[model samples]
Target: MSLTHLDARGAAHMVDVADKPESRREASASGYIRMRPATLALLAEEGLPKGDVLATARIAGIQAAKRTHELIPLCHALALSKVSVDFELDSVTSCVRVTANCRLNGRTGVEMEALTAVSVACLTLYDMCKAVDKDMQIGDIHLDSKRGGVSGDYNRADTYTEQPTPIVAASAEAGRVPLALEGERTPSVRVKCLAELRERFGVSELSVPFHELASANVAGLKLALKNQYERFIDIDDQRLLCAVNQSMANDDTPLTHDDEVAFFPPVTGG
Candidate 1:
């Protein structure tokens, strides 16, 4: 049938795959990050001070795979039996290559889950060191290959295709330059934040049952983080970023403080 995530007019709606059969499916996806040589070196030496980058990234990748529905609208949730993420240092371009694989017995394809896992894991790495390198870009989050279910088997024809434009600067008002490097905080940051929030939190509208503040007053990404983490304790931006990075890194408990606000990772299945 047509995608339900799209609207009656063929807009965007979550596709209902309830009618599909349960079969063993697998998908492989890949992405990359072009980073500074210094950053690569630091990562190689464990100098980022955020613990093992690759290890945390692997966990984040798995978590992302599991939370694909939470990130993308109309995406079906599947019980992924196996998830694997690999990282390779590309010395030529000073980039980090990330590859993710997802497997499950389900009706729908797990392609989105595999790609999402790689994308989120890469973003987590960028966040962990964004303080040091704001220009560090996350690139190439895409489904490289897939197999099983009605869709059957498919793979990307181009091995080195350009990455998807996951992060786009928001359109600026007339007479004002679009948000770019070095300028008064522009709408782009807010736009990117909202985009990410929608992906990380299942809520399309930032409305939650327990949110203390209404969605409108979020002012900026503080809401995006809040959406993903549920509760935002009173904390500085750096610390909050760190806590989020750490939680993603270790797949540990949410950041809770006696007198401070915390960012909680989305609850996982037991």
Candidate 2:
């Protein structure tokens, strides 16, 4: 038996907020829809065939917040003070993030209202663009924060907000990170950077530090790069190119003093 349902057979009783005094309440929720990169580019630069996607999604979210109680069996029909839905385009991830905020002065919190708003907003975007993009995936629905509740204020400490859009496009064979040999006995190495790495670390034909030559293993090099560009990189992305004198190498590759090495994002081509 579900606790949230009001069926007579259910074991739980309705939670009453009658004794509680009205307080200002606010809740925020977020979700995402991922699609092909080209489709995302179109959404950002040009309007869709079905009219403006942002306008429709925003209206749908507002309407969904008002009808939360009807959609959810146990939710209280909130007398919402305000409901705002916004979106941001993340080109690298090929995702559109939908954020919803619900505010009210009521006995019950409006978390459900906010969640419903985000959910429907994402759905509306998928529906309006389904004709052009069939591979759309909706995920990452989560409650970001809540306030004015018995449980106290809560916030998600970690949230991904895409920053510093990738500047360098796909690189051909000629691209390489800045490299220089300083010490007399040091081995010469060519370091190449591609895609996001190039822009994030700003390493383009630049001179290499004396201690940062071709001595460490591939794993160690990755660690060093991560430490140098931690803020701009996603640590989980360990898939980088390890080439020894133009041949593909792995983490086990022993970098010598005279090898050409490069780091690159996964190649994508149609």
Model 2, CA-based lDDT: 0.69
Highest lDDT scorer: 2
Task: Please report how far candidate 1 places residue 170 from its true position, in Å.
Answer: 36
lDDT of 2 by residue, 115-222 (tens): 999999999999988989999999988789999967778687542432212122133224434233233343334455545656655553322232563346666555
* C-alpha lDDT score of every prediction, in listed order: 0.59, 0.69
C-alpha lDDT of candidate 1 relative to the true structure: 0.59
lDDT (C-alpha) at residue 213 in model 2: 31
Tens digits of per-residue lDDT for model 1 on 119-173? 9889888877666677887886777888997756776785345332222233333
Alpha carbon lDDT at 91, candidate 2: 88
Clashes of each: 13, 5
